[model samples]
Structures are given as C-alpha cells and as structure tokens.
Target: MHLLRLRTDVAELLLSTQGAAVLGWSLDTDTGRFPLLRPARHDGNGAPDETAAFPLVPYGNRVGGNTFSFAGRDYQLVPNAGDRYRLHGDGWLSDWTVEAATDNSATVALSHTADESAPWDYLARQLVTLDGYRLTLTLSVENTGRDTLPFGLGWHPYFPLTSRTRLTAPASSVWLEGADHLPTEEVPLPANLDFRKKAPVPARWINNGFEDWNGCARIDWPERGLTLTIDTDPIFSRYVVYRPDTARDPAFAGDWFCFEPMTHTVDGFHMPGMGGLTPLRPGERLEGHIRLEALALQTGYQRATGKDYPGP
Candidate 1:
C-alpha cells in the first residue's frame, strides 16, 4: 500500500493511494491529542470503510435500481460493494495514482473508462492539503466518455463519536430512509433529527439525506476538549448523516459516525432534476472543496484565539 503523510507542527494526516483515502488524521494541541477522524483500523492496509475518510466521485450514495435514463439513453451501474445498489461510485474502490506531493500537501488522480457494468467514464483528482490546524480537500471530476451523464462529488468522513460529541448543521429538510437504506420521503426535520443547534447524534440507525444546507457544519468533542468545523463549497448543498449500531453493523462498536458532504441527493438519478447531479458533456468538469479546521476549546483563562468565531 502506498501511503503519503502530510504534517504541520500541530496536525498530521495520512493518505493512501489504494482508494485515495485518508488513513488517519489527528491533532496535538495544548489541551490534548485529538483524533479528528476515526483512526484507521489497520493504517493504509485496510479498506476505505475502515479508514478515516474517502472520496465520493462521479457521484455519492446509492442509485436506486442501479439504472437511469439520460438524454434518451439508459445507463446501468453495477454494485461496487456488498450493497444492493451502486454506492459512492467507484472512486473508493479503485486505486489512484499520485499526481503531486509536498510536505503538507498531496494530489491523487484516478481515471475510469466506461463499460457495460458501469457506463460512466471520468477522470477524478483529489488534492489534500494541511496548514496549521486546518485541512482542505479539493476534488474535481471531468467527464471523459462519449455520452453526457449526470455527475456528482462528495466525501465520506468518519468522526470519532463520544458520549459528549455534538453536531450542529442547520438544514431545511431531511429525506427519511426506507428499509432498503434508500431515501423514501422528504419531511420536515424532526426534533430528534434536527441539529439547528448543537445536539447529540441520535443513537439509532440514521441514514437520511439533509437538503438546503448552508455549506457549513460543526462537530464538538467536549470529551477531547476540541472542536472541528466543516466548511464546503456552495456546490455541495446536501449532506448525509449516518449513525450505525451493532444491529445494523455487527462490527460496529458505537465509536464513530459519518457526516458526508455531497453535491447531490442519494438516488438522484431517479429524482427530478437528477436530484442535483449536474449533467456533464464530454470534457465538462465538476469540482468542490471541503475545509476542516480544528480548534482547542478554551479552558479557564485561555482567551479565544484563532479564526474568528464560526457562528452556528
């Protein structure tokens, strides 16, 4: 496994070419050591799901029926994982090549060719950079096939979940999940599901998609004495928050959760307007960036110092 490391005085990040995934990321602050994302189970040797985070290229989430019709042509996608539907495209399952690298930044690229199994051809690139206590990831994809297709982008980042972990991301509505783990309906945010304010992630199976996000979110780990703020490009207006338990994932131990920033809704291929998936012609491209800043919560006399307060 080829792994790249980016580090600063206060933070460090590990990336692997296997899936262009973040193996692990953490911070060393005056308060303590904080694992921003869940530590990888076996470093770069593990699968993307076992890593801290991975890219969602071409599209994100599952596409219902694994088929869609665009511009009078129909396309079918094969399930890339054990899931019933094609999930997160193929970026997380394919190996990427290193395009560039430095002490604090690295870029990885992947090229996919259309086939009967999955007919979406594209070239994807991800740039991971670390500066001080902040990390930024910029992902871009270019349609390289003959037919025009709807394309999307996103990131699947897992954060350590603790008893005191809280999330705050105001969204207009949420898509309820069906038994098949696919979205079933759009409804007003429920009190238990609402996070307009800082709230604990409900301890149940949650795989809903949030809509009309303001491109910002926050995760507070009071137990770790640190907080992480997520800022994304306007192109990514939707997000999915997932919380799995032992019932859904036997290997799960309630240690982590996912707050995925996506450019389109899950199963957008079947929704009107393609759910947010942009129709791209050959040579057309789509891009987005996500920034994560880590700050140490102030103690007794520790005055606020760092980026201006990112309001909720």
Candidate 2:
C-alpha cells in the first residue's frame, strides 16, 4: 500500500494507506522528529512500518480479550493477546482513502461496517496539518450503527531524543498493571512515577497510564534548541507513558521516550468515574484537537497551528 506524505514550509508528515496512520512527522527546518511512529520494516521490498498507525478505538486498550457485553449482548473483536480484550481498534490496520491534500495539510477518511462478528460500524476521519513550527493532528469518529458504542481517541507519538527531553504533568495517580498488562490497581504516583518537575525517564521499564492528568504536557529538547508544549482542551484527562526496556527492545536501547495524550486509561470502559468509556449515539460524532507549540528555546520565539488556532 502506498503512503500519503504531507508537508508545509516547516514540517513533513507521513500517512499510511493502511489505517491512514501517521508514520513520521518531523520539523522541516530542524533535524528533530515529531511523531515517532515507527518506520515500516524492510524485508526486501522496502515497505513502510506496518505497526506505525495503531488504532485507538472502541476502547484504547483491551476489553478482556476480544470479548465484551454491551446492552446485554456479547460482542467479539479480533484479539491482540494478553487475555485482554481487543487492542486499539480495527481501523489502524485497515486501508484509508485520501480525500484531500494541500501543501500545508491533508485529510484521510475510512469507513467500516458493523457486522455480526464486529458490531460497530463507523465512519472516521483524520486530518494532519503543519503550520509554521507547529503541527496539529485531529481525529473524528461517527457512529453508524443502530446501537450506541463505546469509544475513545489517543495519539502515540515518539519524540526525538535529547539530554533535555523531559516531561511534566499534574497527575495524581497511575494505573497499576497486572502481568497480562490489564489494570490491576489505581495507586498514587510513587516517587518514581512522579513527574511534577522535569525528570529524565529512569533506567526502568514503564508501560503504565496516568489518571487525573491536567490537559498540559511539555517536552524540551535542548540539543535541538527547541521545546514543545502540548495543550489539549480539557477533553483529554488521561495520559500513557511507554518506555521500552532497552534490555528487551535492543532497537531502542537509548533514552527515547513516548508521551501519549489520551482520553482515558486502558480499559477505561471498566474503570469508575475515570473518564471511563465514551459512548457515541447513532449519527453522533466524536471530535477532539491537539494543539502543539514549538518554541526556539534559545531565541524565545514560538509558533503554533491546530483546529481553531489563529496563524502565527
């Protein structure tokens, strides 16, 4: 499948035909990469990264392993191991059609039917735009099924590495995961998980979700002479941090890290009052926007672009 690539004067972004996923996002003026979506593996044909565009739908995480009950009826989705329900959603791997594109942005759309096996037909759209030093990504889903369905949205982006790369948020608690990676407990942020101040990712494995998160996060890359501040409208109350253990994934044996802005925790559908699961009524739509600002740390100049954002 061919991938669609979009560019502006300041940045370049890639969108895959499969799942219309974002493959790569980088600032055109700098060497830093913005969206760390992985590259397609090269077996021989020189293909793009297959797992780059992970679906964040029907639920961001598992639902007890491809099975769940809604309205007293049982629903089954494709399993992604871990005895945890279906992972991400079906859209990530599905091919998406590019509807429109321009020098500064592009829009891709995909539609799926809710059949007996997977009873959640929906229409989804993803728009990516690069304005000045800022890049914005927006996703929307419309429920086409006769019945309401649970849903959520999240973006998994890999950021360029730098000694100054650090994260800060106002999170009070984090979800404890079982061996199977399911939510086991909601514990207060321990001294290690605490990120009130800018802290380097410790030399340990982390694949946990945080709750009670404020709608703001900051990443500073001093070596690149840039600092990115991400601010989401209050709709995003949860965040996920994934730091692969170098011992396990030798490919990423360095200080690289991920800062995921999500609507809720994994399996939030089962969690209580934690922005749990989102339900979209038939013909209803779910929409959210992420605003990113890129500032020249040394020059103190900034620029931004996103939904409803004014030009720099």
Candidate 3:
C-alpha cells in the first residue's frame, strides 16, 4: 500500500491508497496527533495494528451491513467484516488512484463497476488543500450504475484531548443507543449527551450519535493556545462522538477523541423512510466540503495571524 504525506507550516496530513483515506493530520505546534480515518489500526510505520484506523467514503461510525433495498431491489456489498453487515462502504478499504499532486494539494480518484454480480458502481474523487492554518477537504461521488443507488458521505477526524480541550457547538438533540450501538431514541442534549459545558470525557465508555447540529463546531485548547473551528456545508447535519477507554493501551491513553461529522446516523438505511439514504441517478454525483481553520485563542477569539474578527 502507498501512503502520501503532506506538510505545511501549520499542519501535516497523510493520505493512503487503501480506501483513499486520510489517515493522519496533526498541528505543527501541538504535541498531540490527530488521527485520520483508517479501517485497520497501525503504528506510525503504516503496519496494520489490531485496531482499525478510519473508514472512508461513508465516514463516521456506520453499523449494520452495507446492504440496502433501492427501487424495490435488494443490493448487497462486500462486507468489511466477514458474516456481518458491510461497514464503511467499499471505498476506504479499496485502493484509490492518485490523479494529481502538488505542493499545496492532491487529488485521488476511484471507480467501481455495477453488474448483476456486483451491482453498485460509482466514481469518487477527493481533493485536499492546505492554506495557512486551515485545511480543506472536498469529495465528490458519481453514480455510474445503470440503476440509481442510495449513498451518503462524512468525515472522521480525531482531535487531541487535553485538560483544556473544550468543545462548543449548538445541538438540539442527541441519540440514545441500545446495546447494539444503534439509536433507539432522539432526546434533548445536556439532559443526556451534552458537551456544551466542556465536561471532561467520562471514564465510562461512550459511542453515541447526535443530530440537529449547527453546521459548525469548535475545539479549544487553551493551554496550547490553539483553537480549531470546523465548518461544514449544510449537507452534514449529524455528528458522532466516540471516547474509547484506551487507558489500558498506555500509548494512546487520554490522547484523543473523535468528533465525526456525518450526513446522517449509523443505520440511517433502516430508519423510517430511509432517513439518510441519498439516491443518485445514472451519472449523477454526490458532493460535500469541510473546512478546518486554526487560530490562537487570545484575550477573546483572535485569529492566529493576529487579526481581529472582521479584520482588514
């Protein structure tokens, strides 16, 4: 497998052929590393670790099989886990072809064929660009299948955790999950999964999805003088928070937590009326964008460049 690395004064990001996934991104000034999406866990050397990295294409945490019925026909996908529902779509695990690369950006593309034997074909492209303290990712997926298929998109980025790390976002409700990790109910935040108050991640395990989130969220590391503000286009409405009990690992204990922005819930396919299933016509495309801006938190909300809000 080939891995591509990109670095700038502000941050460093890694891209891998397997799943054409973004594997790692870290701020240049911070001691902590931001874990990119991967399907299998691996050490820094790129060898597979027992744990899975991040899943691509269909990002965030997706459960259930990758099979769904569309237009009265049931379709099945190659399961990432044998005997289980397909997970994270097929792109993240598949090798993507690098079409272009430059000092400031790179583009990778992949195509799938639809036939009676494997009837879901599409073309996907990912573009990564670095601009000062901000990095932007844009992705597009086009259906090449003769028949329409259901789809969605998202990003899985883990941020470093610190005593001063704080998350601020406007969310109306949160999903309550059953043992299987699927949402059973959508309840108001704070009363349940709220993080607006900047509560330290509890020692107890948490793998829950939330909905009705604003298109923006912020992560502040006061001690490090770093602040990351993430803004997504309206297409991304859901977010998933995962705090794994990595205390036993020692290597990654209290290191990071994931703030996943997704287009919908884990099993949106089974939700009433297929809540998050996006349908694409022949030759049609699905596209989304995410922008991450980094700044230095000063007396109050100052840009890293020392410019004030609405500065000249």
Expressed as tens digits, the lDDT of each residue in 93-140 for candidate 3 is 567889988776888888876544246688888888877567788877
lDDT of prediction 1? 0.89
TM-scores of all models?
0.95, 0.84, 0.82
Q: Report the lDDT tens digits of candidate 2 across residue range 104-213.
A: 78787778887654677888887877776676778778888889877777766665555567777779899887877777898988888888777776667788889887
Screening candidate 1 with a backbone cut-off below 3 angstroms (N, C-alpha, C), the clashing residue pairs are none
Best by lDDT: 1
- Candidate 1 per-residue lDDT, tens place, 235-266, comes to 99999999898986899998899999999999
RMSD of 1: 2.6
lDDT for model 3:
0.67
Give the CA lDDT, 0 to 100, for residue 29 in model 3. 47
lDDT of 2 at 92: 63
Better of 1 and 2 by TM-score: 1
Residue 179 error, candidate 3, Å? 2.0
TM-score of structure candidate 2 = 0.84
For each candidate in the order shown, give its overall lDDT on alpha carbons. 0.89, 0.68, 0.67
Lowest summed lDDT across 10 adjacent residues in model 1 is found at 299-308
Instruction: Tell me how many clashing residue pairs each candidate has.
Output: 0, 10, 12
Which of candidates 1 and 2 reaches a greater lDDT? 1
Question: What is the RMSD, in Å, between candidate 3 and the native fold over all Cα?
Answer: 4.3
Model 2 segments beyond 4 Å from truth?
A: 28-55, 81-85, 273-275, 297-312
